[model samples]
Target: MKVSCSVVVFALVFHFFLVTGSRSPPPSDSVIIIGAGMSGIMAAKTLEEAGYKDYIILEADSRIGGRVHKGQVDGNTVEMGANWLFSGGPKSSPAHEIAKKIKLRTLYSDYGNLSSNIYKQGGGLYEKHVVESAFKVADARQEFGTNLSKILSSKKGGDDDISILGSQRLFKQVPKGPLDLAVDYFYNDFEEAEPTRISSLKNTFPRQLMEDFGEDSYFVADPRGFETVVHYIANQFLSHNNNKITDPRLQLKKTVRKINQSKNKVIITTEDGSVYHANYVIVTVSVGVLQSDLIGFVPRLPHLENELPGENMIFVTVTDEESRRIEQQSEKKTKAEIMQQPFGRIYFAGEHTNSTYLGYVDGAYFSGTFRSPSDSLYPLLGRAT
Candidate 1:
């Protein structure tokens, strides 16, 4: 999966105001949705169900289904992005509901399953305690989340200024044994996608310390593609008949480049110079792409600390060749509130926005459905705060 940033804006279009709770009634003005990925498609589906038909989905890629991507190894199915379904709690997630409806086969990769095979980095089988100890590292994990929560609870906090913590810090205490090394290697490797350094731990904690797998996640290794759920969603609107879906509402290869809002209309300029006019627009792209300035907002979006790349260039920047270190960054920065909030008439949705599930497919879904109207927050697409 590629990471890119995007910007969505709401146009005033005169002194008119529309507010229904946080949502307003559907109007004839067409809605332009950028990206055909999970959040984008899901957003479109919601609009379609609400008797709103004047909306169009503009996707940058030739295909839809953004992070819910599947890969092939010798023709065998493999997940390229977001490989698992995490249950938020007792509540049946949309992914679970869809899986049950479609009878999608899923394999449970519980703690026992993961802890069973412990492979060392260089050679030899690593001992089990190291793996077990990784799960028991609650003290270290507790050192990170909201500083206020910690202070209120009288809990000692980690460094305040730091926003991330590299798992390498934990490695310093453990013995340099193969088993210990393996555990450290596996965790640090995976956490490379997320910087271990922490400024506020209220938002996240060490994954191993939490007994959350059963309550939150399941691996999808079915014979069918992992993205089958995305297919089911597309079928809801895009699919005409059982197979052929030729909905003109869904336009592919339309990469949004700029957004300029007038009093009533929002003008969207695509990379190909194709101009689209709409009464409202919903931009759903990645945090990275949004930061990369792939799509420009008329009044300009907030200032981001870094410039991220599209799928084509993520790896080059994420890796640290000199120290052989993978410089993982925490997805949502400290100042994500600025990233999320509604621009003018545009709304934003993506996994980066939902702090409840944060980084999970559920976050993507939550942001897509939860942020109905005027509730335009782009969190990761920014935290709702």
Candidate 2:
């Protein structure tokens, strides 16, 4: 609880940011946020609601919702990784403003808890009206590719950019047996653990195609879990009680490897060498942990340019094994040759850099709440408190 000495926050608030897109505000407030999950705890809870609580988050797991985690099964406390929150009520933003300020408990999930007892692949019992007619031909080929992507974006052709294996090769056809391969294993192996030929049918698919939580799908029956909306948003100022947190500005394992930055500040270090200085450094990890380098910057940092189509993609896109050793050392693309610009004291949050709720938990809470704090530092905090 001590970071207001003018400023020092290098918050690489995990899920990260623009890469080279300048935003400016460093030179002080000492921020070092690098992923206490959910976009570095909503970018240090929107820099402690703009007054700037002199930040530090740095988590590398030993727990703290990076993919919005949580385990335990038959004994309950579910959600292993970023569970549903799409189409929630009262316009579901900020996870329905913290699930209606902590009332929490939700229900309505489809698919993953798929009932009607259908089983096969070796067992038997598979009918339920032929898996509801192959989920009505996979919801009429995702509503005829969302009406042919709004008639090819009314002519210019963009949004809903195809892919569902390019609409099964533009409707030539594929899934036709074992109940259309269990409705393609419930929209590609249980709602995208991948293989709909690089996902994205009608945008992050059905529910997370966002329109402010429309087609309804809410899980989190909150048996005091679903992180109780990250412990009621980290007990507001983070000390914590019944849930036991202890806050040293939420450190956790602090694994970060090497950042560096300079021209004024930035440093970072970790992996036990321990050195943490900051002017501003928000990274928010995952584009599969920045293509699995596991953090090491020193002047070599220009990530984020994944777009994704498929030549057998893994990590949900390229097909993970470190993207099959980055497609056997290159079929090209590592952001073409790196550096696409985006760095002004570094910044980046998540939901794959969010466009319009890009991968949802409401697009990683709108990429960790986007942030504010700089009204030219409020005239030096009105000339020091």
Candidate 3:
């Protein structure tokens, strides 16, 4: 897949308007960016930096930062979503850069320590050598799966639909005893949020977190909250007072109910019965939201098809298959059905739309900042000259 930033988008749009020099759609021929999450805010920032000011951000929630949110617990701030700032790769993620710029406090997650800390069912620590042996076997199994996946991928016109479970069975590495099961759960279900029975070996074998962003993961421990990075990004373009966004361009508590589009402009209707018109729109809502009937489209969108918790606190992350089933009834191949292409004047931006790093914070940031001209609605900006 081609990789590009969102800056190319609004820059082209600015050039489009300037070169055309058309003032026909009243002065209100502006841009409307839906959602105040990472992607939306970054898109707005890119627009402002490109000298495009006639834009508004309609946020469904009362606060900004969408899924990157926080909760108050015992008079202390705690992150409820997206706490890890991945920053070890050769390429720096924008979110990690923002965290550093703001000097946000973070703690390196020593997942490597898990082996030493492994405990048996009785709450007694497992024998050190036993733990080491289990991990060694597990690592070998992972390597076997990875190598097998590569072989399967390289085969021409062959079914690469091997499940992780099948790989484990073929490698004779199926976890049987309680100790083995514990290690297997930690190695597989804990991370994928799904058992190996349903997850594709090709997809699960190559750990994207380590491969894409490197091995380091820093746990955000800022008193100001993880969303502070988002606020800092917002402050760069929007007005703020007392650490709160006061920009009139950012409309909060506005749940978009319908999006009506025409050849020349797009109309957006909020849940509060307020209507907004714009020349173009950037939709940063999640894939689930798009699948649901929560927002109606006058002309139906293209039929592209379309975590977590834990802790001692007991947060359940539903399996990916189960989540997809709940959101979309049909069990069809989801990745193929997902069409990131824009419909009419609406452009889609979010982590889910990002092919390389989907379901990741970096993906959301990158998608908001850059998109290839082919995948984006840059051509729709009338850049013909």
List TM-scores for all candidates, in order.
Answer: 0.71, 0.33, 0.76
RMSD values, in order shown? 9.5, 18.2, 9.3
- The number of clashing residue pairs in each candidate reads 39, 49, 7
The best candidate in terms of TM-score = 3
Residue-level lDDT of model 2, residues 1-385, one tens digit each, is: 0000101112223222222112245323667878876667776776665556577888877877777767888898877766666663445567656876787788776654353667887887676777776777777876676676556545532322556778766876677677677677666546556566655564444443445556466677676766667667777767877777788888888889888887777899888788988878778776666655678777765322232332313212455586776655533233221221346567766665553455555555556665312122223333332
* Collision count of model 2: 49
For residue 11, model 1's alpha carbon misses the true position, in angstroms, by 17
- By TM-score rank, best first, the candidates go 3, 1, 2
Candidate 3 residue-wise lDDT, 191-262, digit = tens: 665677866676555766457567688889988888999899999889999998999999999999999999
lDDT of 2 at 192: 51
Candidates' C-alpha lDDT? 0.57, 0.60, 0.71
Superposition TM-score, candidate 3 onto the true structure: 0.76
Indicate which candidate wins on lDDT. 3
Error of 2 at 179 (Å): 13
Query: What lDDT score goes with residue 228 in model 1?
Result: 79
Q: How accurate is candidate 3 locally (lDDT)?
A: 0.71
